[model samples]
Target: MKKTFLAFVVIVILLSCKQKTGIVFPAQWQNDTLQQTAKAKANIVNNLAIDNTYQFDSTAIVSGCGMVALQKISKDYRYELIIELILDSIPKYKQFSIVDFRDHIKITLNQYSKDNKLINDICTDTPVYSKDQKEPITFTAIEGLMTITNIDGKHSPFKISLTTNNLVFQNADKETFLLPKEEFKDVLVGWYAG
Candidate 1:
């Protein structure tokens, strides 16, 4: 399962290497399902939003690693994006896989204006988190960050920050940054909304 997840991430990264401003949806995602890759990615994260204890995960916890996507979801069309990952299953659900029983992260674009929301709570007809597995995966986190090591034997660093313009890679604190716009525009994290 870990190997498969790694392969998927590699494939997603390779496929996303297109021209600047390119917004490639996951190859598995049909255009009918999600018109906008970023928008769909954000909307698809609803399932893994909570744990059995009914506690919601935070954007900081899920940032870094796996398939990451930043979408716009406000009334007005605002150019924006940020990096965030899924959490709660810090150890078991370390990779990007639908069958992992954990979905991705939902980021609230507090850094941007109110015009275009990041579609954090946007709804979808299909289920994002996979239930094909019987036993539920569990994980632990400290200060909203995953405390367990990933399958790659490392933890993802929270390096990106959301702005009114594009996804920026910053230091640990996200207080400083640079433009990953050209690179990010072509990054496709794939989709698992079914």
Candidate 2:
């Protein structure tokens, strides 16, 4: 009789205890923190306009037989604008130096798009230099939408065309040459994720 009572208690205990359906989520998967971060990053992209601090650094250039890096920085982002003029078919004479007798093209970019009712676009400044570069020759935007000419350099206005992903170099005459965008995936807006 005692044995029978003990068995009954054991069954009752098993029935009373519930089995846990465990599905553990890691810390990174936490929704609250993720939502907050996403919201912040979105705002950064939206409000990205040209900053006064954006300037070209001649020291940050990287050049080789088939590669050239035009580095630009602002309070918002850092980019490597490349102009691949010489193709592989021809031997590299300038070591990818095609712009203004320099290894890489001279360009400074603001981290944000311009604030001319088009905060969604990116602003670029091409530092055109002649015999002397006391001041930048021209301030060229990405879409040719805005052009700022400097009296120090020539008035040749060029534009960046992304429709076919073509980067063109023009003087007073339009479409004089095409500088291919070889590699520019490295875009870092320091405030956001790397």
Candidate 3:
């Protein structure tokens, strides 16, 4: 009886120790699911306001490498506003003060000809214009800030919030153009480079 009880106990222990097969998930499927979840969570909010006046709820925003471009054109195509930013490196999640990162940041506004054949005028950082134009229209970021909220991957989705004070630029023809304070909040931009 003792031997039989011991044998029964051993069998019970072996049964309890037996490993059960679990539902196995493929590695690729797991990775894909994780990526999908991340992409879903990183929602893109495209909102831009200039001087608290001209508001653009949805604008075409694109980015590549260390550059970002935000463009808006009128329905009639008579007016166009393009704000481009060139950074020294890939933007990460951080806030950059225009005053300190002035050298590393380059912003530009381009004006095309009536037929869109040539770039008739441009307002940009002093350095960019200095190379091409004898007297380039230039503007400075007196008071501004740039905040990068997310950078998923090298060629993935990202978000940025940009704000600047009044910007003044003088054209080659000695015309003064004033760009009022601008703000871009939670703008959804994508990186297109590998």
What is candidate 1's lDDT per residue for 27-131, written digit by digit as tens? 636764556755545422232222112111122222122344444322442322333455444244232322233245433332333333232322244435433
Residue 183's lDDT in candidate 1: 18
* Tens digit of per-residue lDDT, candidate 2, span 99-192: 2222223332222333212112222234333342132223322221111111121222221211112223332322222222333223221111
lDDT score, candidate 2, position 2: 100
Which lDDT tens digits does candidate 3 get at residues 1-194? 99999999987766566545333447758998999977654431121122212222344232232256554443332234455665335354566565566555555443433333222222222322223333223333343455555444444356555554444433445443444555556554545433
Which residue ranges in model 1 land beyond 4 Å of their true spot? 1-66, 78-81, 85-110, 113-194
Worst 10 residues of 3 by lDDT: 44-53
Candidate that scores best on lDDT:
3
Alpha-carbon error at 120 in model 2, in Å?
A: 24
Q: Deviation in angstroms for 73 in model 1?
A: 2.9
Per-model clash counts, in order, read: 5, 4, 0
Q: List the residue pairs that clash in candidate 1.
A: 26-190, 62-85, 63-85, 73-117, 74-117
Candidate 2's clash total is 4
Using TM-score as the measure, the top candidate is 3
**Cα lDDT of model 3 overall?**
0.45
